[model samples]
Target: MATPPSEYAMSRTPHFQELRMASGSDNLQGCFHLLFTQQYAEIDGLINVLCEKRDDLFKKIERMEKLVEEGEGLCAFHDSGNVGLEFMKETLKTDKKVLAALTGLLDMACEGRREKRRHVSRFE
Candidate 1:
């Protein structure tokens, strides 16, 4: 059977109010702790990702250096071909353009590497 509201039920009963307060406090504490724990976990994950990105950038720089070295070797070989320099002056001019283009590309690659390092450093 349903009971009618007592004076204590309609008003703030001390015992019931204290129980509610205690439970609320406990719940609030648990929520704050969980929030802090999640924040720490996210921070750790971000650090790991940053480290991996830095490693990847370093690998890219290594690859670019290798490419530049290979390009330089090819340019050297072209310049050293059997034909006399005077006879191939026009051809050498075209070769110079190719070398210049390769150099510009290498410069861009180096700049990209530098920018990546800067970005990764800031994240760290």
Candidate 2:
């Protein structure tokens, strides 16, 4: 009977000579098992490194989202202040009252912007 395909292939390769000699087997199963185990270990290590990098990227994305939220809050605050200033100027029509309200609105807006900046800077 002709030799099995695995034996025939192994017998033709110079690399398997030592394994064949050491195992004294025609199947070469031991050589295949050792190679597979080594490859699996390498793949496991690579997967762990990839998982760590994914977690780091997730944290960075969360930080960026927080900064964007802070910026949006600041923009909304400024828009509301502008609306209030326009309304005061139209309805009051008195220079002194309008100026006083405008000054207060500006002070509040500046304080809000500064608070937002401080919050966003924490993420950086």
Candidate 3:
């Protein structure tokens, strides 16, 4: 399983803390902006990794379907091939939703950053 971006971000706290410590109060905001930018990059990477995992799972499902079709209607691993198929379908559906939520989160975060930049630029 892939580690979530939020959880992975925690591991980067020390680096951000170092940046904060190195900066004066006036530059605190700049440090935070950098943090957000780095986080966006990480989230983007996470999305790519998840998409790859999803693709691999889809390939596995195709292989499983072929195997079940060749075998008697019953699955050796699962009680019935049909049941296993339905299970994988449902699992994929759930994963699809999760991926959508993650993408939405990334979109919202990016939008917020853009808005903040616009607001700041107007004053400068």
Candidate number with greatest lDDT: 3
lDDT of each: 0.50, 0.53, 0.58
- Residue pairs with clashing backbones, model 1: none
lDDT for each residue of candidate 2 in 16-48, tens digit (9 for 90 to 100)? 766545545445455555444544455456555
Q: In candidate 1, what are the lDDT values of residues 31-92, reduced to their tens digit?
A: 34444454445545655565565556556555655555555545556765434433345444
Q: Residue pairs in steric clash, candidate 2?
A: none
* Model 2, CA-based lDDT: 0.53
TM-scores, each model vs. reference: 0.38, 0.42, 0.44
- Model 3 worst lDDT run, 10 consecutive residues: 1-10
RMSD of each: 17.4, 23.6, 12.1
| lDDT by residue for model 3 (30-92), tens | 666655555556656765665676566667656655664655355546667667767666765
How many residue pairs clash (N, CA or C atoms closer than 3 angstroms) in each of the candidate models, in the order given? Answer: 0, 0, 0
**What lDDT is reached at residue 57 by model 2?**
51
Question: Considering summed lDDT, which 10 consecutive residues are worst modelled in model 1?
Answer: 22-31
Comparing 1 and 3 on TM-score, the stronger one: 3
Question: Model 1, which residues run further than 4 Å from truth?
Answer: 1-25, 76-124
Ordered from best to worst lDDT, the candidate numbers read: 3, 2, 1
Question: Best candidate, TM-score-wise?
Answer: 3
